[model samples]
Target: TKMDKHNLTVLNEFILMGITDRPELQAPLFGLFLIVYMISVVGNMGIIILTKMDSKLQTPMYFFLRHLAITDLGYSTVVGPKMLVNFVVDENTISYYFCATQLAFFTVFITSELFILSAMSYDRSVAMCNPLLYTVIMSQRTCWMLVAIPYLYRTIVSLLITIKIFNLCFCGYSVIRHFYCDGLPLVSLLCSNTHEIELIILILAAFDFILSLLIVLVSYLLILAAILRMNSAEGRHKAFSTCGSHLTVVVVFYGTLSFMYLQPKSSHSFDTDKMASIFYTLVIPVLNPLIYSLRNKDVKYALHRTLGALCNIFSQSSVYHVFH
Candidate 1:
């Protein structure tokens, strides 16, 4: 009985510590994270607006990009604000309900983004491989459905997972490791048996990452073959150039996500884990718009028009101020 009491006391103390606190580092970390959050916000919002304003970008590629931007916006919002607040608060605390809400929305946006990227790859395959039927196959109806699948599926699955995790009595620890409540990391703090929840995460993550990557790999393989067959050098260059943006976005986005999720949860180092978490959670969203706009000709043209309009608005505002 005395041994049991001693062991329980030690376990409780460890739980309270929960991922070694670095209060001294909080302010510096806050400033760095804030900049990233802002960049992701402006960058994704700008992409969505650019796609809407540019008539020339009315193709399937832009259609998918608009959705990807929407997902990234939602994804960034889910994690960024709470992390900023942690910098100010002494507890760095999160309530059960709030944490659950964050986890749900985070899962929704992330899974949606992956599927959306896969959809974009398929669009590219069609454009590069079956140019004649591109419009017919990637029709308005088809694109909307592709966008809808993840939202619908994730909503149901995330809700169920959230409920399951919450129902498990967490009479254990509350302090989370990372800035936000990532499922696996949070589950590690629970003293109650949580193997079931962990297994679900592993299985679902495998499906989302492995299955999605296989689809993308097959699609891109066919695309590369078709790109190689083009006889004219200019034709081949244009085709490859058109796909460059999506390829860049895919590699970075999936690479970061795989790094974060594909490993055994036990091996995730706190310092490096936080850094890797920041990549998929914060950085990729900001980079996606820049990658697409910088590489794609139509997106570049649209951005110029947007800049002209913004400059006009600023100039007019200045004139009004002077007259007043």
Candidate 2:
């Protein structure tokens, strides 16, 4: 038991070398990320609330969007608070177990978001290509199944990956070069052979990217064909408009992800990786809700109506107070 405890203490914690070590940059970066995190949380929460409360947003598309917001919120919260703390703290250290937990949750949410986007694309395709049977095809039961599968699948995958990574022998070196505990950075710290784990990470990353991207591409192709077949100019425009927000989101998400993880190892720079990670993990979450809400008329309308209703309630309460 004493020997076991000694071994555990040896790998007790990790120093997270955050975005920058410059004293001058710390406060500014903290302020910037703080604002970014706040907006991300509020925006994603607004999307979830709007989808839930607005009958107009009760369709299958909004259902997927609600889950997307949730995953965005999930991963952002997992990383953001710890990161902000690291900026100001004398030591940006995370405990061994805490790092593993962060990696696990980050993996789960990021992977789930990818598949959820794929599901959303499929929803768009069904709505556009098979308008007549859209409701029947994307029924409530079917919608729930699509989202449930990703969450369940990713949870298992993340746990396995986390367990495998943590099981490696981390000795002497404990400073993670990046802001958070990412797979590659952790792998690099292992004094033991990293070949098998490297291969596994590479395979999993490739599989996730290719599979999800393929779904999005095929769905868009189908949607494109359906749009061309429509005789009405207005109909084509409406179809394209409905698809635009989702397309923008997919492009930004996948593009940044591919650039970050799919690069050759020789070309990898921790600084560059940190920037890319910041974009997807923090910036994108804030962008998704804006992209969806501002671009989609239905979402915009629902937001206005919701705001209007709240205003009415507040105004009525004020009048009642004045009378009393």
Candidate 1 residue-wise lDDT at 61: 85
Candidate 1 lDDT, tens digit per residue, 212-315?
78878988999999988989999988888888888899999888877776667688777677878778888888899889877777888888988998999999
Kindly report which residue pairs in candidate 1 clash with one another: none
Candidates in order, TM-scores: namely 0.88, 0.96
The digit string of per-residue lDDT tens for model 2 on 64-133 reads: 9999999999999999999999988988999999999999999999989999999999999999888899
* Most TM-score-accurate candidate: 2
Task: For candidate 1, give the lDDT of residue 223.
Answer: 93
For every model in order, what is the number of clashing pairs?
Answer: 0, 0
Model 2 scores a TM of 0.96
- The per-residue C-alpha lDDT of model 2 at residue 142 equals 99
- Per-candidate local distance difference test: 0.80, 0.93
